[model samples]
Target: MNTVPGFRVISLPRNTTVRVHRRSATIVLTLVVLALFVLMLTVATGAYEITGNDLVATFLGGGSDMDQFIVLRQRLPRAVADLLVGAALGLSGAIFQSISRNPLGSPDVVGFATGSASGGLIVILLVGASSVASIAVGTIAGGFATALFVYLLSSGGGKVSERLILTGIAVGAMLASVNDYLITRATLDDAETAKAWQFGSLNIISWPHVIPLAVLLAVLVPLTLTMSGPMRVLEMGDDSAHALGVEVGKTRVWLLCAGVALAAAAVATSGPIGFLAMAAPQLARKVSRSPGISLLPSMAMGALLLGAGDPLAARALSPFQIPVGLVTAALGGLYLLWILTWRKG
Candidate 1:
């Protein structure tokens, strides 16, 4: 067969596949090493001195009951919680950022986290519910409803637009105020509990938290990964995306739902940990040096940051034991300042 003139046969590997795999490997390795280091540090702290041998022995299932109790029952759950929360936030942030095609389009920025927090707070305050199930349900509903509202209000003129950002900010601020009110009205005991949640703590986490979150992640994280293909396409500007056969609205909704589910689950379990969502994706992009949104790497960064940050916060404050959220909030605040200043100049 004769080849047609001016037609060159060239095989090109998809950039998306290569980028996803390379970024995923690097990020996952970094997260694993950091997670192990954090786990060791966590086991070493507190009343008992858990040395290298102790950690090894405990993990081998050969340590004393007391050693096992401290490692398994106490520190381990908290460490696991930190990792789970980090991963959830990282995935959620990447999804939101990609969908909105704005660096500031994270769940934290778009009010999903705040809305989740508000819903969890309502359960805590009005319903006086303390179970993880109740809180999770409330958070999922609240986060989803808020995003839908933001989408709708922003679409007043036509399709989903930049106005969604503005509406989300307004909605988030309002929900935040309500959260404060709930906190203020809580009884002393309830207030203490609510405060811990609002500030994002891993102190009281247990197997109960671990089980539900593990199940949620097993389902939601994979869904988030699968949706990344559509998100990447959607990032190429809306009109171009639609023209290329991408269902823009449907993709956005799916991404939003997955992101909200992940964020809401984290909020229900750990009470809206600070900036992991926003910070993780930014850090992942920097590390991977990949253009556009990097979901897998962002997740790895989230796990690394939270898993490591918890222990650093623990040691920095000693017996006081600062909440992980406070540490991240301070870090996030610095990042926010830098971003604002950079924009101004």
Candidate 2:
């Protein structure tokens, strides 16, 4: 391991290396503060308007019934959904990106989200599954199935990163087309419902959805964080990882499954919120200058982007709310361009 001045890199047993530094603490802190600000603003500024002071009063149990209903039952749930979805997307993205050692290897790009969306769409259009529980089951199943397919296809070739990425891309493209076609074949009402899937939104978030997603994130994010060491090693390439005694096969399978679960949870909660999983890790690495994608920073960036983007999407065109998915796509697209230009220069 290489270390420069003011930095210490620790190599532990089993080929785990730890890097310690505080250079980006302030930046992360600032982002966290900003996220909190955006979240409160989102909760307060809506159709059933509640100002900052009123929001605090409601939280402390003083607001009227309407305000309480709006904040507690509606706006609060949506905000929580945004945060949970962001965290899931960010963590999922970091896991896949590190595992593949490629920026394009995100759940959105890789077919997990597409697969999940397709599954949800099928349940809605074909089986008439409208209940939360059934939809969740279908969505998660689709994502897992897609991951298995990708793994199987790439396994025959030794799970090469490039090959897996290409396979996933091909699968994702096919699934996306299928999703559109399914929409076309559905009835008018079903088609309208499916349109929301095309552009992910948080307007329909309820306590039931919020609770499951929060519970899943509570379990999964911490679980994924525990593999950071192995993830770091695995990203260093196959030979180095094996030399470090990392169980190349087992670790990859676990991380890949965890990533699919995370991505599936987010998609199930908020539709295929495109570009979030792809953008969050890349943005974190850019800001922190970490050797590889840092988990906490990526989660924070994802939360900040989605949390803040919601309100901006609402207000960007007065009296007309754009979908959060569109906001993320536009924002992520600009960031992608900047990265490309910066790399070229």
lDDT of each: 0.81, 0.84
**Candidate 1: regions farther than 4 A off:** 1-24, 44-46, 156-161, 340-345
- Each prediction's TM-score against the native? 0.89, 0.92
Candidate 1 local lDDT, 1-345, one digit each (tens): 243343223344673232234554666787778777776677667767777787789989988899899998888898888888888888888887787776677777778889998888888888999898898888988899898888878764443546776788889999899899999998989988888898988888898988898898899887777777678988887888888889888888788889888998888888878777887887788677676778888887888888888878876867778888888888887887865775577
Q: Lowest-scoring 10 consecutive residues by lDDT in candidate 2?
A: 18-27
Q: How far is candidate 1 from the true structure (C-alpha RMSD, Å)?
A: 4.8
**TM-score of candidate 1 to 2 decimals:** 0.89
**Clash totals in order:** 0, 0
lDDT per residue (tens digit) for residues 279-320 in model 2: 888888888877777788888888888887777776788688
- Position 212, candidate 1: lDDT: 92
Clashing pairs in 2: none
List of clashing residue pairs for candidate 1? none
lDDT score, candidate 2, position 7: 59
